[model samples]
Target chain A: MSITPFNIPIVPKLKKETIYSLARKGSRIDKRKLDQFREIKITLGAAGKAHGSALVELGHTKVLAGVKIEPGRPFSDMPDQGVLNVSAEFLPIASSEFEPGPPDENAIEVARVVDRALRESQAIDLGKLAIIPGEKVWVVWVDINVLDHDGNLFDASMLAAMAALLDAKIPQHEILEDGSVRIIGPPIEPLPVKKRVVSVTIGALGNVFLVDPSLEEEAVLDTRIMFSFDEEGNLVGMQKTGAGWLDWDKVAIAFNIARNKYTVPLRALQGAFKS
Target chain B: MSGKKPPFPLLKDGKRHDGRGPMDLRPIQMKVGILHNADGSAWVKMGRTEVIAAAYGPREPPMKAMILPDRAVIRFRYHMAPFSTDERKSPAPSRREIELSKVIREALEATILTHLFPRTVIDVFAEVIQADGGTRTAAITAASLALADAGIPMKGLIAGVAVGKVEGQLVLDIDQVEDEYGEADMPVAAIVGLRKIVLLQLNGVLKPDEFLKALSMAWEGLKRIYELERSVLGSKYKGV
Candidate 1:
C-alpha cells in the first residue's frame, strides 16, 4: 500500500481563466503559436566526477542529467543484454510544492516514460555490454535531477538525458586471470549510442493543444500527453497522464502535431551536441 | 521494424496461438458480489488470467490532510498475489506495481463521481490471482464493477483491453507469450458511451499509422467488453 502524492501547484482561478481563454483563440500567454516551442539551451560535461553530464534549460525549466556506468549483474530476463536504469529526483529547491522524500507518482511516471523510450528504441547497443553471459554486465544509469521547476518536465528531462548519454565515455575494463573484470583505465571510449530518440509533450487547454507548455499553462491544462519518436518518426513510447480524458479527435490532432514537430527539438539537441 | 522474427510463430493465417482471430478476445467469465462482507466485490476470469476486486468506503478518511474539500479521494490499488504467476513474485511492491496502481487509479477516476462524497475516502483494491497478460485493463474492468456494486455513482463504466502486433499482423487481447515475444504491445482503457479514452500506454516500436490503427482496434474490443459489464451489473442491481 502507498500514499498518493499531494496535488501540486495550487493555481489561481484568474490565471487558469486567462490561459484557457487565450488558448481557445490559438494564442499563448508567452506569445508562441500552438505548436511552437520555447528556446532550449544545453551545457554538457558539467558534473565534476560523473562519466557524463548535461544540463538542459527549456524556457525557465532546468534539468541536469548525469550518467554513471558500473559493472552489475544482468537481469534474469535479459541475461545476454545489459541494463539501462533511469531515475528522476525533484529537488526541493526546484519548486515550493516539492519536498524531500522518496519519489512519488509524478517522479516515477516520468522516469519510467523516459526509460521505455530509450529501451524500446534500442538507442544503445545494450547487447554488446555484457561482460559475462548471466553473471555481470555494464549497467548504464541516467539520473535526471530537476534543478528548477517551470513546466513540461518530461521534455526537458529527456533532452538532458539524451545529451548526457551521447556525451558519455564508457570506462575501460580488463579481465583478470581469476575471471574478474577490473576498470583499468580512465573513461575513454564513447558509449555505444546508436539512435537519437526525441519526445514531444502536448498539453490540452480544453480542445486546444499547446506544445512545450510553461509552468502557468501546465497548472491550467485539462490533461497532457507525451509521445516519443525516433529519428525516422517511428513511435516508440507513449503515455497519457492526468485525470482528464481525451477524445479520439484530439488524440489524432496531437499525434499529427507530434510527428511533425519533434524535429524542432531534435535539431536543437543535435546542434547542441555538435557545438 | 519487421526484420527479426519471433522464435516461435505467434500467428498463422490470422489465427492466434489459442485460436482467436485478429480481432477476437479471449473467453471472458465474470461474477459479482462474491465477497459478502465487502461493500462490493467481483471475480473476473479472462482466459487464464484471474482477478478479484473489492470496494469499500465513502467512509471517513484516515488523515485530515488527505480529505479533499471538493471531491472524495478515490484510492485504487492493483496488486498481484505471490502465486499469481509461474515465477512466484515476491509480496513486496515492485516498480511495475507502483506505476500500474497509479495508472489504474487515474483510468478509473475519470468515471467516478467523487464530488458527491467530499471529505471521505473511497477505496478499491484489485488483486490479480493469475496473470497472463493485460492485467491492468482487466483490473480496471473488475474494479469498476466492484465500485458499482458498492453503489458508488459513476458517470460510466470503463472497459480495458490490449492490442499487439504478431508476425506483422495486428491482434487483439494478447496472451503472455505474445506479450513477451511480440514486437509491440499497447494497453488502452476507455469509457465506451462517453467515447473518451481514460488510460493509454505503449511500448515497442510502431509506425504512426500502425499506432493509430491499433488504437482503433483496441477501441472496438473495449466496446464489446463494456457491454458485458453493463449486463452483469444490470443483472445484480436491476435483476434484469
Candidate 2:
C-alpha cells in the first residue's frame, strides 16, 4: 500500500532509561492519557438517500455503515431469533494495503467482532423479528464500509453499525399463507430493540495504551483489544486482535479503562435515536 | 436469453412504458465532486439508477508487470453496491462486473489523453449505488464528468446512450425492463469531436434495418445529451 511507505519507521528497542522515564511520568507520545478517548463525531444519514446510514469519525479513522431490511426466512435452527447479517468491505483507496476483492482477514475479523458485539449483547430484540414463527422473519443486513483506515476500525465500524440500526425502521407487514407478502405501511409502534449495544477498541503500544489509535499508531501497535457493553454497562463480548503477546496485567487495565469509557457513548447513542 | 417474457410492456397508450416518447430519454441529473477526497468525482442519476465515479492519482506507475511507456495506465473499477439490487449480493466482484470494468476501461481509454502523464497511473472507480436500466451508460457519462472535474485534459467529453428495439420499435435510453425483454439492446459511446462511436455492445437479436434505425435514434439522442454535457461543463468552468 502507498501509505505504508509514508509511515513512521519502527523504532528499535528503546533504551531502558527512556522507557522508565516515560513510564514514571504516566504520559505517552501524542500527549494522550492512558484511558482518554479521542474525539468522536457521528454524522447520521450521510447517504441520506439510503434507507438508513451513518458515518462515524473517531478522530482520523472513518467508517460508514448502512442498514437495509428485507423479509426472508429465518434460519431453521434459530427460527425464533431475527437474523442479523453483517459484512465489512475495506475500500482499496482507504489504505495502501487494501486490495480489491473479497474482503481479507482484517475485514472479516472486523465484521465478526462487530457481529459478536451485537449478537452477544442482544442489542436487537430478536423475538419481535419473527413474522411467522417458523416460516418468515425480517432479516436486517448491516454493512460496514471502511472508507478510511487510520486505526481501531473495529470500534468505529461497530459505532457506525449501531447508529445505522437505530436509524433503521422496518415497515409493518402481513404475510399470507400463499408465501406472498404485503407491506402494511408504517408501523403503529416502535421496532423492538431489546438493548442498545456499543463497542470501543483500545490499542496497546510500547507499554502505553491509547484509546482510538490513529493510523500511525495502528501501524506501530503490537495488539488491539475491543470491548462491547450494553446500556446496563454489562460486558457482552471482548475480542483481542493483532499480533504479539500482552501481559494479562495490561489486559486487566484495559478492561478497567473500557468500563469507564463505555457508558459515555451509550448515553450519546440513546439520545441520538430519540431525536 | 432466459426465454421468459419480460413483465413490462414496451409501448402503452401510443407512448413508451415509462410514458416517454420513443426518442425521449429518462430524466438525467448529475452533480460534480461528491467524493470529498477524490481528485475528481461526479454522481449521475438517470431515471432510478445512480452512479458515482471517483478519480484518483496521477501517481507513479504501478510496479507490477503491466506498464505502458507512451500513455499513462488507466485502471477502472466498476462495482455495484450490495444493496443496489433487489437481492443481497455477497461482497465479491462477480464475473459480470469484471467484464463491465474491462469494457468501460477500453471505452474511456479510447479518448482520454493519457500521454499527458507518462510513467503514472490514473484510477477511476465507478460504483453503482442503484440499478435501473442504462447503468453502464450512466457510469460512462458520470466518469467523463468526473474526469472533466479533475481538470484532466481530454479531447472532449464522451457521452453514452443506448438504443433498444422493443415491439418492433426503436427506443432511446432503454430502462431495465426494456433492456431485459427488449428484442435488441445496442449501447454506444460517442465522443464530441467527430461524433464517432468509441464503444459499442449489443445483445439479443436485431435485423440490419432495426440496428440502423436504433443507431440513428441514439445518434439523435446523443446530440441532446451533448448539449447537456456542454452546459454542465460550461457552468462549472464559468466560475473559474
Q: Can you give the TM-score per candidate against the true fold?
A: 0.96, 0.49
Error at B189, model 2, angstroms = 59
Docking class of 1: medium
lDDT of 2 by residue, B1-240 (tens): 222366777798769988999989889888887788999998888899999998887777557444555557777878889998867866587645654665667667656788888767888888999988788888888888898888877777878888877776888998888876766566766675555455555544444445456667887877777778778778877888
Model 2, span A1-275: residue lDDT tens:
10112123444445334433453477545566756666677888887544578888877788999987778888876776678888999998788778799875567667766876676556778778887778878888899999988778878898899988877778667778787668777533444667777776777665666676666556666556676777766555555555333443355566667777887667667666677
Model 1: residue A26 alpha-carbon error in angstroms: 1.2
Off by over 4 Å in 1: A1-9, B1-7
Per-residue alpha-carbon lDDT of candidate 1 for residues A1-275, written as tens digits (9 for 90 to 100): 43434465467899988888898898999999989988998899879678889999999999999999998888887887888999999989899988899887778888888998898899988988888888888899999999999999999988898889998988989877876789998899998999988899999777789999888888788778889999999999998877777886578888899888999879988998887
**Weakest 10 consecutive residues, lDDT, candidate 1 chain B?**
B1-10
Please give, for residues B52-114, the per-residue lDDT of candidate 1 as tens digits. 999998888888888777778878888999999989999888778888888888777788898
Which parts of model 2 are misplaced by more than 4 Å?
Answer: A1-24, A184-190, B1-240
RMSD of 1: 1.9
Candidate 1: lDDT of A24? Answer: 86
Model 2's CAPRI class?
Answer: incorrect
Deviation from native of the Cα of residue A65 in model 2, angstroms: 0.8
